[model samples]
Target: MGPGPKVKCPPRLAPCGLRLVQVRFPTGLTSEEYVKQEAWRFARLERCPFHPEGGCGLARHGTYARVSPPGCLIARWWCPTARTSISLLPDFMCSRLTGTLAEVEAVVAAADAAPTREVASEVLRPDVELPGALRWLRRRTRLVHAGLAAAIGLLPGLLARCEPTITSVRSALGAEVALVRLRAELVPHLAALPPPLGFGPRPAQRRSSLTALQQESGTDPPSGTR
Candidate 1:
């Protein structure tokens, strides 16, 4: 009888590249030394069980592999043209069994959760307030106020014809400088100012007294008194 068609084991038989690899050192080696040695070895290969399809290629084609202790390997191959290819990959194969699983899970989770350009753009939405616009508006308003103050300062000599241009120039200069000083001075003055008139308990006491007087007279309090 003809030999039956050769059965190909599923590519998934290869270890997942996403899992962490922990190599235990002999009693003589320190943990730090063991880590350095393994890191160097993995770096030389440029292909670890944690990234089996080999970096970008694996990601693009949705292929992955996982390797476990004592050289247990599993992998998944995907066909880009097939819509169901994603399902063929080992889904959520817990890498928790490995000694370094926590570190591996953390790395993988962070990579998976990283924000894309689209996500960043959405977060910094166009509707958000802009510091630049506020700064520009504030500058323009200050310029307008300075211009108005300068014009007002020149109003006193509008009817005078002798050296009107010089007078206007002087007035404008003085007004602008005065406005700058006033802004500086007014801030401190306002900081020192007490609260507005009638803001204290005196107003409430007066209102109560007025109401009592009105009640004895059996008439509404005068609007002026109120």
Candidate 2:
């Protein structure tokens, strides 16, 4: 499976073989040169997951704005077959969360380590005006737990013994990197799960473990590089 939000690309630039064009910008390309650089960045794509009929259906669909990382613009592509757009996001961003992956990881780690509600509040969001920081914490905590349960068929002993929050999960794992492990273990099917915070419009109507369930059920495909 792909490591990023699902979207496919660039083949039939002809002699380059058959595949979808990558929706990327080469390193160091300034915003000023964005349009000019589009051609080269797309050369590395695999295939359009939506419209693979003739490779002519995928078109530039523009970008989305980001905070934390100032001036960031997420690239997107339009798929006529799917009648919807799919965009690629870096590993540092979660599929539906508003914060960057690092930002989310840092907050989780801090919140997990603090021992009391006061400390947890301070560690997660020093200022109440930051609104949604704590909310994101709650939502992501559940997301991690659900993904873990779906993947391993059980929660760590400590978490099972206490509240099933990231704070508890971290304590159960007794490791500093538990959040990272959770993020890494997370699969795309998260897109379909019930959002602990709330729901937005999306195609994945119900939860299905794209990778973890298959492995747990003994029906997983061969291990290979993502």
Candidate 3:
């Protein structure tokens, strides 16, 4: 069988947007219990007659909750990618700190709401053009060209020896392998060499250290943090 094709990493992050919410539950509850509570709350909301019943309506759904030490439950709700509405629970709770369910319902009724933002077309843009295939072709073409040039430079010797085909093949193969190895070694060494005199931090190392800092902080690291 012929050699399998090589795989390359894609150049961009996936188009999907991830939303994370951090919900704190009372201490001593297990992850399962917190998730159950969230699920129940969501279900209650979904069944409530007050809930809007149409495009982008709210509904309770099961979701994985990350449980941290000392009984912290972070429940995340993902707004649909196309929907951008922010829940007013924060404001509602703050405003109606001491009120009956009916009174709170009045507050919910009184709050004037705004429409959610539309998803940006640019955000869902198509994948980038594939340059990997073109790059590989160029490298191979250069190698072939270099080998041909070297062989032509040696043509006189081969003609003198009356062994044109064999000598040409050997010369080209040797030159190609030598060029490949030289590139393999030289490029990495160049990369490993500290940034040019004034160049800033190495991207990979900087990213790793930043990630370490974020993990230590115990908060969701910045987006694209990883």
Candidate 4:
């Protein structure tokens, strides 16, 4: 019962103590298929996540479903000695945030293609008021842009001197789903950064309800903050 991609952190480093990591698949699998088959049961960890030596009582800890992406269950394990648990999130889904990776990318892509944020909000979220829609669009846009910047710095050779934009990432990686592809490249450092890249701040077992605005804007940092 951590934040479902609805939680936003400040611009500065905010480490949520959650031990969630993504599990990518070799073959192509849609989010729907992943949920329908309960693919998380197939997730494996060769070594103890918390205690990599050999054995530390790391065992399957059951599954938890997310609010978004109906019926999706997160596979998890726990280290009894360490008194901690790790959730193996399927790559098809966005960490911290709700929905699939493609859905997040699509939102950013649509805004990137729009002439202006105002226009993008209108088209992307006509159901909501203009101000709320803009907030929703800006949150995703900022997150994607920030993640891309971090990607450039992380993958110097692959993305050296490249602009931090969706177009640049797509061209550099040669993939349409740039964020998902980028996630694989930055697997080792995923825990250090924010979701889609890393997990953001995790409060001490706190779960707050999302307001109407929060529901519209999945993960918007406070105004005037990152």
- Per candidate, the number of residue pairs that clash is 15, 15, 0, 6
Each candidate: what lDDT?
Answer: 0.27, 0.43, 0.27, 0.66
Off by over 4 Å in 2: 1-45, 129-136, 153-226
Encode model 4's per-residue lDDT on 1-226: one tens digit a residue.
2211222233342434543444444325678888788787787767655456645566776777776688777766655544456667666677766677789888888899889999999998999899788767766676677778878988999997689888888888889888778877887776665665455532222233224334553421211110
Q: Write one digit per residue (lDDT tens) for candidate 3, span 90-186.
A: 1111111121212222222222121211111112212423343223222222223333343334444432332222233335446422222222222
Candidate 2 C-alpha RMSD relative to the actual structure: 13.2
Off by over 4 Å in 4: 1-28, 200-226
Candidate 3 residue runs with Cα over 4 Å from true position: 1-16, 21-54, 69-76, 81-212, 215-226
lDDT tens per residue, model 2, 51-159 = 4554446565565554435544556665554444555544344445554544555565566667854567656666653334444455555455454444343334334
What's the TM-score of each model vs. the native?
A: 0.14, 0.50, 0.21, 0.74
How displaced is residue 204 in candidate 3, in Å?
A: 21
Top-lDDT structure, candidate number: 4
TM-score: model 4 vs. ground truth: 0.74
**All predictions: root-mean-square deviation over Cα?**
35.2, 13.2, 29.4, 9.3
TM-score of 3: 0.21
Ranking by TM-score: 4, 2, 3, 1
